[model samples]
Target: MDLNTAADAHALTPLLNCLLREVAEPAAEHGEGTHRLRGSGRLLRVRGGRRPARPELRRADGWHPLSHSELVELTSGELRRYTGVSNDELPVDMADSRATVAALLAARAQAAPPRDPYLLSEQSLVMGHPHHPAPKARGGAPAASWLPYAPEAYARFPLVFLALREDQVAEEGGPSAATAIDSLADALDGPRPPAGYRLLPAHPWQLELVGARRAVREAFADGRLLRLGGSRLPAWPTASIRTLYVPDPAADLFVKFSLDVRITNDVRRLWRHDLLTLRRTDAAAEEGFAALRRTGSDAAWLADRGYRTAGFAFEELAVLVRDGLHAHVLPGATPLLAAALAEGEPGSPLARTADPAGWWRRYLRQVVPPVLELFARHGVVLEAHLQNTLVAFDASGMPVQALFRDAEGVKLLRDLDRPAAWQRLVYCLVVNHLMEIGGALAERHPDVSPFVWPAVREEFLRYDAARGLPETAELLAASSLPAKANLLLRWTRADGAAARYLPLPNPLRD
Candidate 1:
């Protein structure tokens, strides 16, 4: 396939998968080229199942292949007919998502990838959130506007520095002596702050988008905030687009900034309430990781150290500092994004492994135990979905560590019902994270597929004796696993935090 066709196919796969899994069912297959959509009684066909699905619609004359735009139109019409709910914006977003993927593909061709394996893995998620309909959509913004900051394009740029007046500064939590936010200032190549002002960094792209807001304008006008140019060191955007990684040898750190665009279901902003409880959540995660380490698991949680922002633009301008991989990673080991591992990016250890079964076992040993221990022993439910987890591999390309991040998504048992928290954990850790990796491995080594789930069950059994989790028996015996309904959630326009799940067949069940 040509580059444009290849890009369209990658973009169309997730959209079609979301529509099929969430809204439609299969009625019949005619040979390998045609099937019927159960909801609309419309005949359709695709090249693959779940992902990389190339859709075609049956017509009067013959089977008509649908382009990405045509597939969006078909999906919109089917959803309207199936649910009688008309959505105008989703179609536009769908088109925007396809266009964005095309732009990313084009840009990646011209740009050079980061030499660092970690950064390359971070930027490798060109086809993001494999199950979400509009994962790449940037709130319908022009591709030119966001491409400079797009991770998939391997784009890296300097941060915009700001000087905030003392009284206007708002912050929460405290940083460890080693990973303090103040240390970041030493690397800035921007104008010096005025004598009484404190240094704060803002994402340059975000500043361009929100600089015109009344609060930001007033702050600048009244000298509450001063623009001090950009940083000297370039920051690499990770898979999570809003977060950037600075590769400073002396003070390496990951800085997360608030972007006002809707990525997937939610607007990517640092909400005030999340910031208020940041310390509690982060402390819980740190404690949870420590407990796991005592159990001899090489799992770590990247601490979300303090944030700094103006009181008026708390969410929009807020910047969060996180621990860099250099300090936390195992000796002689390289960390890679778990999602990229599943998706089979260049330099992925999974792709290069000589022994798939042994590698899979090592991966399970590193990943599963820590998550289960944290949930049962510590009451900390990590959002251990593929995107949030990082798998570090030793020199031999065997899995050596599993590191989890993102304090915002953590749920404590004290805050949520234990049963509910366990369910969410199962969904995030198993259904969303492990299943994808297992599927990728199976695709690579179909001969060893039979051993996959049996091994997972054995791993669970190893933990069952000590923790005795209430859901243990049910998890092993359940007919279905909870799968998040991303398509329906977006269709119903529900709050992003309000997750609703549908039951999918549990693969681990005997």
Candidate 2:
């Protein structure tokens, strides 16, 4: 796990130099031999043993070497297919009389030229439906349909689409805006997944929405759905009112609509100022929004610098354009399953045990700092909860990226009557994010008793001292900012030792 050191240099240099070359960063330095790697792109740190002979430790291009378990799980098949070799050809190392798989992948001294040398046009395949015919001219001016009421469960804005079975004519009742949504709930008698077409299974969160009939109908009638002619209907199935379309076997682009209603309601209120801050297309304008999360600010910064909004919003709807930040969506992408980690489900990557703390440690090391940076720049706070945050992995199974969504939950501090910026930050950053995982960790390891909610709060304060101590003092002095957040930091670090805990459930054992 100790990746920083000269001993790892031999294995690191090959990949590191190649990564540097790829990025064209001639001035990149290897800090103190083992200091943490730093960069802005997806290719983070690339270090692995060269040809399994001379071990190399390097950091370049966000692509880090996959862990042994990850490598075995992700690349074994690809290695077999690419090398045209059976399991026997793969190397096995006998360490302490235990057989271990160790393949000597040739170290490409020069970072392999972008793997496939095909034109961008030749390389990309048309995603979703390859062919979508125009709607046949048969009906009168399309009748308008509007959802009579909105559903309470629409907190997470969902990008929806309208679909009709192949047999359903353009002028049929199902095609009308009103009934188009109803079609999703109804089965397609004639429509079937085409040949070679695979159905991507919907996750539990997605399934929950699909199962609700009223929610789907409201979403459809509200014009939140993407319209597709006959052939396009198969790819974007919103015909049924009872089911939310899980755009699987579909493209990565997800659209969620945020109408004026979401902002107007007193409950789960979204302020207009927040809307104004979010609406500002200029990344330079981020300095004013005190509630924006560090990651959100970075996004605005990137967008300001001519970086395409791999994601953006049009009115209440937000679209994720499957580019840039969203380039890599992994299996354990959403932290939803991780939310249930205390309950046994080894399949989930977030299930941290005493032995495999690497994933969470790396996750925290990479994510938290950037998050704080974003918060410092934009007062906007991103609710990077289990669901809103997504983990993107590289070619290997290791997590190398993070995707954050749910713009509605993203809060603006000053917009509130009395902005408790720090309180909000602590509630979200510590109470929400760390406490959930910490509770799970404490459950697994009872010996680590000091790692309670208060202890975690102190640890956060310690981290703040080390990273943001100057800013912390300045914020305390700034009367404009909320004092609760500042006080929480002080009380937790100075007087939190005697803090009594209310009876709490055992997060893990239960």
Candidate 3:
């Protein structure tokens, strides 16, 4: 497919997915790939597997094909009719997202894909978040402004070193892990600051965005902050644009920065609220994974160990140091992003896998048990969605381990009761993560597609039978699952953290 066609299709999948999921009537029989719009009384048709594309709308004249732009307009109009709200901002974001895809494709053609499967998987989400409208939107910034730092374009850039006055540096976490931050600074080949200052690495793009601000400039002028140039080597931007995975063993850590620009649902920033609660959340998740490991499962959690930032521009200048995969993943296993797997990235190393059944079973074994255990035993409801989850495969191309990250997204039992926590876990684990990956697996091995959901049911059944968990019993009896209403949330211009959920069909059988 050409750029426009490819971009349009890439952009339309989520929009159509939203429309079909939220706005369209469920009782309307979807013949093949066609469905009737709920409120507008319009007929729509599509024919594609996984990421649906080539959308057509029916009118008195005949079938009218909708491009990405038309899809955006239709989605906007449908959402307006459905929600009775006019969201002018989302359409522009949708357009920007398609344009961003074109820019990424163009840049990727000239660039070399990473040799590491993990890096490639990290950058493979060209059509990210199949349920999110405008998932690839880059805050409506100019393509030139964001393209060089985009993960999809294989972006790698050195971190801009900002030396904050020792007295002005704000941070929290245990000493052992926090010392790694200082070690990373001492290790990097950047200009040394005067004796009293500490090194604070900043995402170059974030620096560009927040540099012109009055507070940041004032801090630089006074002596609270000093610009000491960038690091000698570049770091690979991960799926979450704010996070970068440093390749070197000395500084082998995932660093997350506060980005001012909006991506997907929120301004991709390490907010102060999450930062304040980081240690507690990280500790809880760490305990959960540790207990799982004691059970002989190699499941791990990449704890967000510590963070450092200037007190003046805390939100904009903050950075967190997360545990790297090198320590967590099993020997001879390659950690691949779950989102990329679900995306059906063609170049994935899994091409050699012939036994889809065994692979799928092993995958479920590694992923499902730990997540359920975390919820049931530790009361830590992990945000184990595709992006936050990684499946490490062995030399034989079978899943050997599962590793999860992002302490900032974790919800503690103190905040949520058992029922609420269980509901969220079911959605994140079953609907958002497994269903997509399972769909990709089914698409690849249609011969075993019938076995997919049945296996999932079996896993839950086995889990319940082994643990005698009431939550699993309730889930098995439940008729529907909660899916995050991304399209509707965007249409209503709601906060990203203020996620709204709607009922979705459950495939589980008693």
Best by TM-score: 3
> Which runs of model 3 end up more than 4 angstroms from their true locations?
26-31, 347-351
lDDT of 1 by residue, 358-408 (tens): 999999989988888888888889999998999999999999999999998
Model 1 ranges off by over 4 Å? 28-35, 175-179
- lDDT of model 1 at position 387: 89
True-structure lDDT of candidate 3: 0.86
Output the number of the lDDT-best candidate.
3
- Tens digits of per-residue lDDT for model 3 on 100-176? 98889889989998888899999999999999888999888889999889999998988888789999989998685
lDDT of 1 at 432: 90
lDDT of 1: 0.85
User: Model 1, residue 131: what's the lDDT?
Assistant: 86
TM-score of each candidate structure, all chains considered together: 0.97, 0.37, 0.97
Worst 10 residues of 3 by lDDT: 25-34
Residue 222 Cα positional deviation in candidate 3, in Å, after optimal superposition: 0.8
